[model samples]
Target: MHTVVIGGGVVGLSCALALAERGGDVTVCEAGTLGGGSTGRAAGGIRAQFSTPVNVDLSLASVPVWESFEERFGVDVDYRKNGYLFLAREEETAAAFEANVEMQTARGVDSRTLSPAEAREHCPQLRAEAFVAATYCPDDGVADPHSAVQGYSRAVEERGVDVRTRTPVTGLSPPESADGPWRVETPGETLSADYVVNAAGAWARRVGRLAGVELPIAPRRRQATVVEPETAMAESVPLTVDLDRGVYFRPEREGTALVGGHFADADPDVDPDDFSESPDLAWTAEAVERAADAAAYFGPETRVRNGWAGLYAVTPDHHAVVDEARPGFVVAAGFSGHGFQHAPATGECVAELCLDGAASHVDVSALSLERFESDEPGTVEQNVA
Candidate 1:
């Protein structure tokens, strides 16, 4: 089967690679350079600590792929399994963490709840008195987002899949009949494919409109800042999150760390084409302050090195819309902020839907666009970062 994938982010590249591996003729068209979208700007976090079973299953399926990425793709993605620590400061949030741990543990994730003292033991930088409880998963970690994107791009090209950068898909024509192929239009030429996968990150809703389908994906701006702390941070320190404050920090290069979080009532619905790419000074100051409360090493003396803003294709439920939205068209977008970590499994599922008419690896039927048409849309995923 001939398949055309829209968007050139990590998810789109992975889908193309998986399709090529399945012996399907594939072509990937990106409007800009590879990984130029939200994928390149991602924080590179990979974790299985989730409140929902479907998300946990998706992460579980993707973790092994990330672990063996360098060996399989011949590119070192810098996969670091240091871990992810989530701190809860209030009783209600602490109870939620307990429930999340129970849900994650049932899904075979080795996540355990810890006391404030125990959490501080994992990272001496953490302020022990700031939180009531925490959750830690030793296997959850981070990787190089750029390396992963380039790795998958090369792998797909090696498999004879045509990857066209700077080739923007202007329009899409769904099949005229049951047996007709979908017509994909570009500025230079027109192409036909048996199937089309819409993996357009922040522009997924627009891409869906081209096919006469309406998707709930909206672009929300998120920013991250790098701080050079006055004190050095231990390399073993995991990515720590203050769930109550909506702030997080993780060790970056030596003596530096990356910190970011959303402020209460600060979430902005941004135009994917026209939003600030640079971080705001006020938001950066707030994020750094929150990070300092979570980790003592991120003191007030910490200097901001740099920062950038990226868009997250947020859905109403804050989960991914990963299903066949239209006949001959498959969607794997609107992951809120979890797209990078879950791209591997989502790609496999998209390929499975295109080739086998069903997804066996990870069942994503719950993420269908049809769910929104009902009175109850879908479950809101609580572990978004």
Candidate 2:
């Protein structure tokens, strides 16, 4: 079957690679350069500490790929398993962490709850007295998204897949008949495909409209800044998160760290094409201050060196919609902000949906777009940063 995959970010490239691996004719259409969207701007966090089972399952299915990416793809993605530490200041949030750890433990994730003192053991600079409780997962970590994109892009092209960069999809339509091919129109030419996979990242909602499907994906801008800490941070320091404040920081190098968070009560959606790519000065100052409050490594002398902003394809429930929305159109977007880490599993599922008519790798039944139209839309992932 001829399958046309839209978007050339890590997720889209992954889907195209999976499709080609399954002996399907695949063509990847990217509006911009590969990994130029959310994939390139991602903080590269990988974790299985989600509150939802589906998300954890996605991590379970994908992390193994990341663990062996260098050997399998012949590309070094700078994969680091420095771990992720989540802090809770409120009693209710601490109780939720306990429940989340229990659930995570049952799913084979080596995560455990920690007292404030025990949390300090993992992160020496942490202000233990400031937090009521914390959670730590030694297996959860990060990798370079750009490197992963290079790996996947090369793999797909090697498999004889047509990867069209700078080719924006102008129109998309469902098949006219039950067995007719789907129409995908680009500026240069129109192509017909047996299947069309929408992996458009931040522009997913717009792409969905072209196919006459209304996806609840919104583009929300998130920023991260690199700061030179007053005190040298250990390169092995785990990605520390002040969950209550939505602030997080991870060691980037010998003495510098990447810090980010959304401090406002409201996270309004922004235009994907018009939003600022550079971080806001006010937000960067607040992010650093919040980081300083969480750990001693960041102080009044912390200097912000550089920063950039990216969009998150947010759904109302903060989970992805990875289902066949129409007869031959599949959606693998609206991952909130976890798309980069979950790309492998999502790609496998999208390929399965296109070939086997059901996803066998991960149970994506809860992530269907129809869930939004129903009364019980399910839970929203609380561990977003």
Candidate 3:
């Protein structure tokens, strides 16, 4: 069957690859260059320490691909298994952390709750006195987002998928009947597809509307900065998160760390086409200050090297909407910030949805858009940084 996948980011390319591998004709339509959107700006964090089982399952299914990316895709994504440490300052938050650890562990994740002192073992500079509890998973780490994108792009091309860069889908028309074809219009040409996958990250809502579906996906601006700390951070240092303050810092190099978070009380949505790509100077300064508060690595002498801003296609509950919105139309967007890491698993699930009419690999039923319309939604993932 002919499938036109929208958004040529990592997730889009992945879905195309999976579909192509399953003996389907696939074409990828990207508004910009591959990975130039949120994928290129992502921090490349891959972790299984999630608060929900579905998110954890997604991570588990995707991490193995990342772990063996070089062997499978013939590209070195610089996957580092340094680890991820989450810190909770408030007692209530600490209790939540402990509960998350239990859930994660029950789901086969090698995660465990840690005392403040025990957590300090992973990052010696951590202010143990400030945090009441922590969680760590040695298997969680970071990778190169661009490299993964390149790998997926190359793999999809090898599978005979048409990848069109700088080609935006101008319009979309659903199939007239159950057996009809969907029309996908681009600036260059109009393509016919038996199925259409909406993997358009920040602009998913716009794409959904073209098919007469109202997707409640909002684009929220998130920024990150790399700083040369006063004291050199250990290369083995885990990606530490000050959960209460929404600050997260992971070692970038021997003496440098990448710091980022949402510190503002109000997170207003931004236009994906017009937002600034560079990080704000004031926000960078505040990120460093917050990082210092979490740990002593960032001192007064810490210098901001560089940073960039990206958009997170956020949903109301911070979980991705991976479901078939209608027959022959699949929506796999609103990853909030986990798109890069979860791309592999989501791709497989999308392929299943298109080919088998359901996802057999993972239970993504709770990720459907209709859940938001009901009174009860899925569990909210609280580990978002």
TM-score (all chains, Cα) for each model:
0.98, 0.99, 0.99
What is the full ranking by lDDT, best candidate first?
2, 3, 1
Position 118, candidate 1: lDDT: 96
Q: Candidate 3: worst 10 consecutive residues by lDDT?
A: 376-385
lDDT of each: 0.91, 0.93, 0.92
lDDT of 3: 0.92
Off by over 4 Å in 1: none
Q: For model 3, how does the per-residue alpha-carbon lDDT over 1-385 read when each residue is reduced to its tens digit?
A: 9999999988998899999999999999999899999999999999998888889999999988998999999999999999999999999998888888888888999999899999999999999999899999999999999999989988999999989999999998888887999999999899999999999999999999988889999999999999999999988999898989989999997679999888874689999999999999988988899999999999899988999999999998889999999888899999997999999999999999999999988899879989999987667777456
Name the Cα RMSD for model 3.
Answer: 0.9
Each prediction's RMSD to truth:
1.1, 0.8, 0.9
Which 10 consecutive positions of candidate 2 have the poorest summed lDDT? 376-385
* Model 1 per-residue lDDT at 294: 79
lDDT of 2 by residue, 1-385 (tens): 9999999999999999899999999999999999999999999999998998899999999999999999988999999999999999999999999999989899999999999999998889999999999999999998999999999998998999999999999999788899999999999999999999999988999999999999999999999999999998888889888999999999997779999878764789899989999999999989999999999999888888999999989898889999999999999999877999999999999999999999999999989999999887688897455
